[model samples]
Target: MCNEMTTSLKTEVLESPLEIVLKGSNTKFITAFKELLLHPVYSRPTLQFIESSVKLAPNRARVLAESEHGRLIFIQLLKQTESWYSGEDNFYLHLLNSIISQLLSADLGNLFLSTFSEPIVNEDERLSLLKIVDAAIDSLLERKSTTLDCQPLLEILFRDFTTASAQAIPFIRSADTSPEYSDSLLSQLTNIWNRLIVLLDIYQTILDNQPSLKPEILKDNIIEELVSLLGEAQKSLPRRSKLADLEKSASKSSSGNVSDHDDLDPKDFPLIKGKIIYLLGTLVQENKQVQDLVRQLQGLELVLTNCIIDLNNPFIRERSILCLRYLLANNPENQDFVAKMEAKETVSEDALHEAGYETELVNGKLALKKRT
Candidate 1:
């Protein structure tokens, strides 16, 4: 009865009048609301109010985040919600995520960074933090993918951000774009890539502190998609090299849209492939299910074959080897399977040559390089 009365009070009496009222520098209201959060029944509606208020007036995110009572409310709510967090989709979790997402989309990411500057209480909190960071990465990936029309990434690409950009430029048949626009687009894409790395670094820090959560983090199925991304990046490379030819085709055509190839290029992203490899390595390390999943995709060979020196990947060869070690460790079937594979025939090099390639010496050994 009390809960019902409180809900009614929130909906009827407080709804309109309190909406504007709450946004003020009212310490008492924030403190009292924090108390309501301690009650299960009232908490949900209260948090909903918080999210809705932020949604209605985006700047209130800073208002809510920076204030002492407001900060305590969020922290208390975060702790309180753990009791009911069933998975990534629970209501409380989603509400919290919505609020955070709103804040981030508003260019208020500094708030989250500031939140992290304080000491984290424990692993659960840190894991929550990591998953949240991953979500932010996903948002960036989504924006980045908008360029690819690719589903984008989900593919492993090289370390140097430029390689990803180079791979992407041809999609528009680079020759067709104004040099200025391409440079501008290139700059924007590089900025997005840099932000992604910063978030990934945050992920690494939390994971380093609580390594066991790697598999838990993998439950999102990042590996399956990224391995798929690798295949797409590799297969697309040949096609990208041929993108210049599309200009020839376009010149002959009367109809033109965003340049079928211009939708997004795999190389538009920087250090994408290397990032993909590193993320997957974290996911599959010491996890049999993920290892088997990679093995099943013929991903084992796919990965091994690409383990070559590429400037875009910097230490790609090394990273790939380490990832392979993780894939094979303690899993004898994968071990024996990999052991039986011929090093010379790991992947069909014919595809690379067909795409166009040149041989060169690298660190004193001859290596295949895409023809510049």
Candidate 2:
């Protein structure tokens, strides 16, 4: 009798309306799922429910597999497990974390991974999701209530970084092939790159918490790719328009004083040789490679200092100077290198050279040759 009843229930559950609801498109399902997810009881038990549902409704699993709801549930469950790890003893924490890790590892986080890899997704949709994921990852990383036993989760994110960076080259090259598509693709690519940096920052936080989980492979290759991608994106920017927009934006805010060159169009931004140094200075000052590479890019430093010194805008000059100071200050090993570069360029020289003249030399000190 018990076996008969179990079979009956399974049949009924398989034919249920909820299972039917899961068959629809991902956007619709996520909309409905969000209500359930926000409710305390439903949200907390989501993982257990999902696991069981997948077993009973294999078809529903595929639909869920493609849905935002699925990724949301997975991320939420991982975070909740992190919370449980703090209060639970090592034995149970290890066991639970292991289970969560296995689930994410089985397919290398296929559900979350699939969302970005969707061939049908437009660049606009991709950009929107990237922003959403960035915020979600940031919130997850900031959760102090949770223990950081999430190596599997971090690995999944690392995999994402790898795939995104690989696809970027093709997208960038093809972007120009279609102007309308290129604009949207460029916007999407920028968002992806920005969010990856944000995600990398979170990944670094996890390593700080659980130092043993740092992947040497990622450190060696993935980081270099990330920096290279950022440099490439900066180069692709419409410099004149972007700088004009940046100046206008900067002026509205109280971050610093306005530049005399602030009113100057973006086309005038100095280009050195074949390299675009536009935001390389910003990246050097901001990225973790600060001590490692930014300090070493003293030619970049010279370029930035000269650009700022001649600019009419006080704000732009101050920002560039501040960045230079940071690159020099961050690494002890690079300090001597910075000092040597500074000493050599301390004297003002002729403006006849392409990079502009050092207009003033005071007591053997180099200064931007004032534009007469």
Candidate that scores best on TM-score? 2
Cα displacement (Å) at residue 164, model 1? 13
Across 1-372, the per-residue lDDT of candidate 2 in tens digits comes to 333333433354334544454544545344434444445544433344455555454344544445555555444434344345346445333433333333333433335445544453543343333434444334444666644345545555666566656656554444334334456555665555444444454454555455465443245454354446544434442233347665665675566665433454222212211122323333444344643654343343443444333232334344444444444443545444434444576422221122322234557654333234
Provide the RMSD of all predictions against the true structure, rounded to 1 decimal. Answer: 17.2, 12.7
Candidate 1: Cα lDDT at 137: 44
Once fitted onto the true fold, the runs of candidate 1 whose alpha carbons sit more than 4 angstroms away are 1-22, 25-184, 237-268, 347-372
Model 2 misplaced regions, further than 4 Å: 1-63, 66-111, 114-133, 166-218, 233-247, 250-333, 344-372
Per-residue lDDT for 1-372 in model 1, tens only? 444456545655356533444455655555557667777667787778878877777667775556555556666655664565654648777777677666666656555545533353232343344345455545543563322111111112122222333334344243233344467666554444444444445445435544655655565555665676565555543222245544655564546544433444333443555666776677787789889999987777766765665543445566676677677667766755654453345533443343344345557644554456
